[model samples]
Target: MKSTISLLLAAVTSLVVGGIVVTTPAPASAASLTEVANFGDNPGGMRMHVYAPDSRPANPAIVVAMHGCGGSGPGFYSGSEFASAADRHGFVVIYPSAQQEAGFGKCFDTWSAAAKRRGGGSDPVSITSMVTYVQQRYGGDPNRVYATGSSSGGMMTNHLLALYPDVFKAGAAFMGVPFDCFANAADYPPGSSRCTGGGGANRTPQQWGDSVRQVYPGYTGPRPRVQLWHGTNDTLVPYALLQEAIEQWTDVFGLSQTPTSTDTPQTGWNRRRYADSSGTTRVEAYSVQGAGHSLPSAGMAARAVAFFGLDGTGTTTTTTTTTTTQPGTGACKVTSTVNAWNSGLTESITITNTGGTAVNGWALVFPLPSGQSITSGWNATYSPSSGQVTARDATYNAAIPPNGSIDIGFQASHDGTTAKPSSFTLNGLLCATT
Candidate 1:
């Protein structure tokens, strides 16, 4: 059914960009747009646009793509290229329209205490209603549902993951703050230092994670896999928030404070993965170097689809170059750098293939100082045994071409003493520390 709620448009005269508000031309993909008026007591009177792919699978996957402040549902369809992805992947994509009535220029009220709670506010309830509506009316598989968004939309993605974990299998948040990062909108209203700053405000990892747990109190079901992306140069949403978001998700997934694997799948795009005991990655984070307050044009949607396991044909391919190397020696060289302050420490290890041949698979071995321990790591599978830490390449990063390097990072707890590893080994060969 197509229903228009024109009453709310008067309040949404402009769109939010970073801290600036500007008028955007109305979206043009009106032909395929279907407006949903009443979604289960939508107290906020929010509308939604559902885009059906040219052809859908027998059991279509559903993706809810939220727009940033000042963006409409139809606008998200064009801006995010979500409809193209849906058409290619045989999934149904829903764009939920946030109204100015909800505050912050049509942005979902992610900062509000009521919005943070499960089954408490209009935004979450209305979004949940959309999921139910999609599943019943559009043949969307409840198990394969996922969500992704930008800016305010991204914040709402975090809100949905926390409040309605059971409804979404996974979610990807781009340039968004952590769940309940602020108690109320007034505390850190959009575009303020507290909202745009990338760092945490004295909140411990446990505290940040607890913010999410509190939203769905006493509801223990399968938690959704989370993927976070942040541009390092984003003035609107600081890059430091990426670390805070990572900490929050690590706590939520009950993973260690450190990442299990960290690596650069591509130049300028760094990723860290946190895995469960069964070796399944439950949380992933990306740092988009040099990007400022913008969405990733190519990899975001593809990666999210692959992460959700909704990519058609049930398989995804990663291209990597490989070379033969003898154990303990060959073309691989390792370099390690550590940053420690007080009791907190972080380390980055770079492995470079120095030989003319590409190195197919590799591992880095090193010993930590007596008082330092590995809490978490990323890009490589990290395990510590007998005071020594060993990191192996993840599937996507296993192949390194000649002169190509892969870097991994980890967080650790120290005893207020500085301890640096003197030497490193790749495939059991000693490497010179730079």
Candidate 2:
């Protein structure tokens, strides 16, 4: 029986949107919106929106898209920078909404009593629900699904990192302080204390980011790569505080040395790259020269995904010569890139066939962000249409002749959206649909 199910997962954000360089195109494949779970009735009315590419019965990537202050599920995914790519590439995206006004408007109550209220705050459960929902209903890659958000949503991403480290392999956040430790009333801006309940409360980004790091120490569970983005001009969540938060990340992430910044290929951007003392988990921070507290909504999403070790470092520059006429076949493989460093929207995939049967005419597809556009490709002829991207063997040799295999690669721009496919399929075969 063929079935399509909807899933839900959630997180929160307190930061604001920096600036939109451009509105991204929606994904190429069929885009569907379903509420897999709800928080208070699921008030906060938190729900998850899953974007699936046009591939059939395959395990595609899964990306978690969270919005900034006053933003919820629809608010985040409707015109999201990653929308276009999700449709065109066959990927899955989950949007988690925040609470309502009396609760604290659209932003995740980063400062409200219900925000992370342990057994009370439905936010944590909401995110878990999203993951379960997607897995059961959508067949997403449990390991590949990731979390990303702007400001409070960004804060929510960090919260997921602390709470559900195993649920995701990576995260990309912009203008957000650490989840477990962001400043409160006293630490908030001059008149900001009124908004944060006058400080005397709980932990800030500093505490949260640090505590989560320790709880999921670099040596334990599956430590996911973390990418942070912040603008120098953010008045709401000052750069200095975020800088301190970066330092703490380096420490808890178990980095031996301190992390600093340097300029990148793009102007108005600097990177704070860190390698754990053990050189295991690599962490990076992209600082926008004079950005506000908003999500690089269109900028950092894709770029950060790349920095987390997902993007292609250049196609299989490793193809072997046409050895003997002997037969040899292999499973297909994919290598993709996410901007991770630019717009933070990055991803790359290299799909290679490792079996002995040179399969004839096969289709490969996965999910991507809406804002990122595919600039270049190689090996086989490729086309991204209908919110679903397809690559095929050269007409000269469409078949993966006996003992032959081919590798295909691609690059996607994330713009703050998680570009992980819940599942993927090759040549109509369910290589990984769930």
Candidate 3:
């Protein structure tokens, strides 16, 4: 949650305090700050702050976190506790500061036509360049990258996800307007009535998605997974916009408007999951029943990390090997194949119970190459530490009778060189990896 400041906080010149630079209100802390002058085409400049673990892992995941209007990167860093999560999860977080050059108090210029078009303007291109710079300099995984933000930053998150879908595997937007909600900067910060009225009040879901499709025309590749978080009582960005966001993304993913499943994981939170026919979750929305205009400090960040498959602790490399199972034992045979590969890699693994008896549960342990990192997965609990990966079945897929099988899939990023694992072990017994 970035610090929300009044509109009067906007400034014409950059403000520097204790080595921390801001374009709006001053941030509370100034640590590990690095400023990128003349970022992209924007004359106002951008500031970046990094939060890396004590011992960085090989090809670690990277998250590009954006601050809202009138907010500083350092302010969001402290308020969101993303640095602590990075320290615990062995990932790298980059906070990109927004400045008040557009008369909107350091807000992202999301309402502009340039902001809506891919590679046509500075904001999206500059952010993409920042991600590339971090990945090249810090050994961040190119495939496992993600973006997230609140308010204006949240709108930019949607912009990035739609324009650069190949660059980010997933994104989360909090209390943001739909993509291309406004055509001109003069209509910036649309009032509550207009916001709730819907960005495309008369357009169909396909039409809304077509707006995104036009950004990267001829793109027939996989779309990024989406997560939306909004407070029911949000007045700044009305809660009704959530439905529009859902509609837009559903069309983008070619999913039905209706959710596949809806559940209350905890009190005051309603979660809806949208999936494809294969049961792969493509989109999720969380609505805080009574909350308003704020980030969910309790579990939002951690939940996003879990969803991204980077929750494992530490940066140390560990290796463990198991002996081959005997013929009579109830062994689980595993086979893995690369379903797709590009800037990232998506692989599918099938585990078959070949023994005579049923197994109550299963776990697969394997080694990932130094350049590979898991970004998102389905039908399994994936935990990766350094070069090792552990995959466990979900509750519904835990039981496996004799001759039964279950399939798990995950998306991973590599440094242009992808190498499949040579071997796999299920429950401490070696299974042939082919």
Candidate 4:
């Protein structure tokens, strides 16, 4: 049933770029879940729960998983697939419970003036406190912290990223509205139908972005990357808000509203990716056809994990290119760069198909140096994580057109030596290197 909520014109567009494919599961780790009675000052009166894998890196990434209205931290922890993903990718998960308001049914604050301002107080502060606590106690990577949620929790996802851009690297909000979409309704009851029922679609992208900028005036730091998901059939929170959200984030990223690429990564999923000149995707929106607020069907969380780069290493900088190769007949050029630290390093390998034909469904094979093992990666999947590793293409990057190159990278731990791989092969054929 369509929502009776009044809405202005919502321009929902579907631009297809590539065909759909399924995702492969990453490696796995066991998990231990727990609850913390005292995390910090209970500014939002939120309860804290956490999930950590049995095996974790010295410094692991952290993800704050919030629940919808009437939901609790423990509830979201058990119901969401993020914890299992943390097990597979080896990260920390912080679940925050929103205390019940007289008329709000335990929804995260997204409308009030306090919730809109940075450090103004509300669920955002409480959630950030939980993140800080995790960082201090578990050695979580401060630079790799992220947030994600569904429904009301999803609205808070937008709020947290807008208010704490320096604190969160990226966020994935499923079925969420734009930041500050509900600000005008501060005087209205909590969970007012005005915003959730499609009344907030009247604002322009610039106006929406301005709302976020106003939160942290004069702060010029990098805005957090955002991933938005919504169902076309959503009634409670009308689907129109999705477009507004895309507009808001695209404006925040200073990118054109036009998507760099569009595709159906999965059947019924119309995905739009907004990237900058460097081809780094800053915003991604998934529109599920004929679906509702109960989005994030099977395997959706995995997509969020990939988008968050949670399946890969921490921040890295290019230091040295170890190998460079030229293209020949059916031959490919491989360039590898390394950024080394104390015991771990991030390696970025770019494969260029210099041949006349496209290389499809390819796999690159190479051996890791002794005592070196991969912990996480992106753009491709690595197996064995150690000696004689195979890097296979992800569903979205399964092909490299002629004269085109794709960059794939991973983070690894080493004993000491940072020796480069002596040789590389693509689909059993030898590749050239410099």
Top lDDT hit: 4
What is candidate 3's TM-score against the reference?
0.64
> Per-residue lDDT tens digits of candidate 1, residues 286-364?
8887766666343356567767776543322222222222122234566777798888789888888786777666656
lDDT value, residue 373 of candidate 4: 91
Model 1 bad stretches (over 4 Å): 1-31, 101-104, 193-200, 313-434
Ordered list by TM-score, greatest first: 4, 1, 3, 2
lDDT of 3 by residue, 12-91 (tens): 11111111111111222233445554334443256767666665688989988877766777767755645655754677
After TM-score superposition, what is the CA distance of residue 395 in candidate 4 from its true location, in Å?
30
Score every model by TM-score: 0.65, 0.59, 0.64, 0.65
- Where is model 3 poorest over a 10-residue stretch in terms of lDDT? 15-24
lDDT of 1 at 133: 88
lDDT of each: 0.70, 0.53, 0.68, 0.74
Give per-residue CA lDDT, model 4, range 358-428, as digits (tens). 87677676757888999999999898788657788897988789999999999999999787775565653
